[model samples]
Target: MCLLFRLYFLARRMHLSWVKSALVLWRNIMIKVGIAGITGYTGEELIRCLYQHPKVKISSLYARIEKPIHFSSIAPRFNKKIDLMCEPLNAEHMGDNCDIVFLALPHTVSMEFVPFLLKKGKRVIDLSADYRIPKDSYELWYKHEHTDSENLTQAVYGLPEINREKIKGAKLLSNPGCYPTSIILGLAPISKLISQCLIEPIIDSKSGTSGAGKKAEASFLFTEVDENLRCYKANEHQHIPEIEHFLSYEAGANIKVHFSPHLLPVRRGIMSTIYLNHESFSSIENIQKMYNDFYKNEPFVRVRPLGKFPEILDVAETNYCDIGIKFARGMLIIVSVIDNLLKGASGQAVQNMNIMCGFDEKEGLF
Candidate 1:
């Protein structure tokens, strides 16, 4: 009889411990997010960020070819922490299964799924060029037909400092390109100068190799990229049209500028040197006041004080975009840099999602 009482006491103690553990687990649970392209590097980064977040949980991980394996295979460091398998990407089920869906597909692919997700009332953040360009410009550069014309026109350019308010209300968030986001924020204040039709800002932008993604190509391999610093799209990059369109829209004029992109040997980040007519320098105080006031309330944008410029390392793993402007040779030379993968792509998409879903803008972003 004494032995039986001891056994009962042991069982009760074990039960109570499990109950307490379950309560703790429930209390600190995270907000589940669905990643639609789990095979890519950006997708892997999101997995990494969320795995560490106190309030974020990855719900659905999707990969077209790698649909039946653990996420660790693609990103080994993730190892056991993310032992989940990826499923196929289907718009029909995405909205029902996950709280939010992130599309890291190619440019035109998002158009096919984004509308359906929105219709099903799922908030979407696209990390592709599909939603970045206007319908006509997208067709011009991407060389494909965009069926969701309305969404493209209304899509908010997801530069947190500039469009956070619109992002909060948007059902579909159109995250900007790596180079464009970096370049635009740096040159925005001078946009008024250009708007007066009195200034022309020329952007000479360069990026590190990681912007090419994990895909294979003779051009991106070590042999080709090492000791190589060459310009690819001289004046005809897809992002050019996007920059022009947004600038024109913001400045209320037909904005045109010389856009050039170059490839650097390093792995990530971009620096754009822009030249604006010296007549548009405005006062340094006015310039500082404008950029500071513009991004004053914004969390991710930092406008360096006069004579202080932003460096790539300053924002390497962060969601922030830093800007520094100076006048030169009757030209306003502006330089901007970003991680190309973070602030330029996956990170911004998450930022837009936070706004659209009414979650804390900083949740899981830092």
Candidate 2:
């Protein structure tokens, strides 16, 4: 009887230990994601966010151009924490390295590596202009011949609010531009965008110096932009068509916006003020209620109080887009702010990754 009882007790303890180990293994399997172009500011931010995510892990970091150097040599933030070599972007290694990949390189740059990733059967969230728009638009505006034109239509535009359902299942998603991300989120809650609507939206966006990239240029020099704001890519900016395309498609009508971009002196952030034409101003109470209803569950969007506008400082370090709406002379004026490097680029990509990988959308973003 002593031997029988001892054996039964030992078996029960072994079964419980096995169950615990199984749960731990399941949890880890949900986590390991990777990043491409990890040398860039946005890529580093993705790494930073994943480092904190309970359900995600940065198992790999890739950079084709920034290779043959230590991560810290390229970007000091990853100094010792990321003591890994920057490897080239390829599908051949991703299955061994990571399950999800974020391409934070330039538009044209991402196009070259995607076919390999697809062949490797890896999911992608591209933070580049290459896959953001339609193929013809990419060809016309970017002036680059697309190597993956056939796959362009299949790449889901990864704006969560408008295309949440599709994004949840997409194997490849193209994250929106910083300007378009801010502008669309600011305008969408209140936009009817009907063809007969006489509203002409003027999206005046000003971004910090970081939007230009890490490369040094005389134009982006401190002496040049210290206290000045210069508008570039005015009415004909590339983002204009993207904004119009999303707005029009969402509202089921053609829409045109006078998009104007400006460069600011700060290091990071975007402040976009949208001016709308409406015969009668929507009451502040109604506007707030509407926006609140629309984005109530969206963890990253904040609708500011009616009397107060959002400042860049409030959203500078977050993956949030702060939107404040005001009305005057029958026009709705909106101010939307975002940390261009975070919400505009990497955070959004991670959010899309969470969706694609069947993790909670806010797993790493919030």
What would the per-residue lDDT of candidate 1 be over residues 22-120, giving only the tens digit for each residue? 344332444567888767767776676666666667777887763467767766787877777777777677756665678888778878888888786
Return the TM-score for each candidate structure: 0.87, 0.87
lDDT of each: 0.74, 0.78
Q: Which 10 consecutive positions of candidate 1 have the poorest summed lDDT? A: 1-10
Which stretches in model 2 have alpha-carbon errors above 4 Å? 1-30, 89-96, 193-196, 280-284
| Clashes per model (N, Cα, C within 3 A) | 3, 1
Q: What RMSD value applies to candidate 2?
A: 8.1
lDDT of 2: 0.78
List pairs with backbone clashes in candidate 2: 107-130
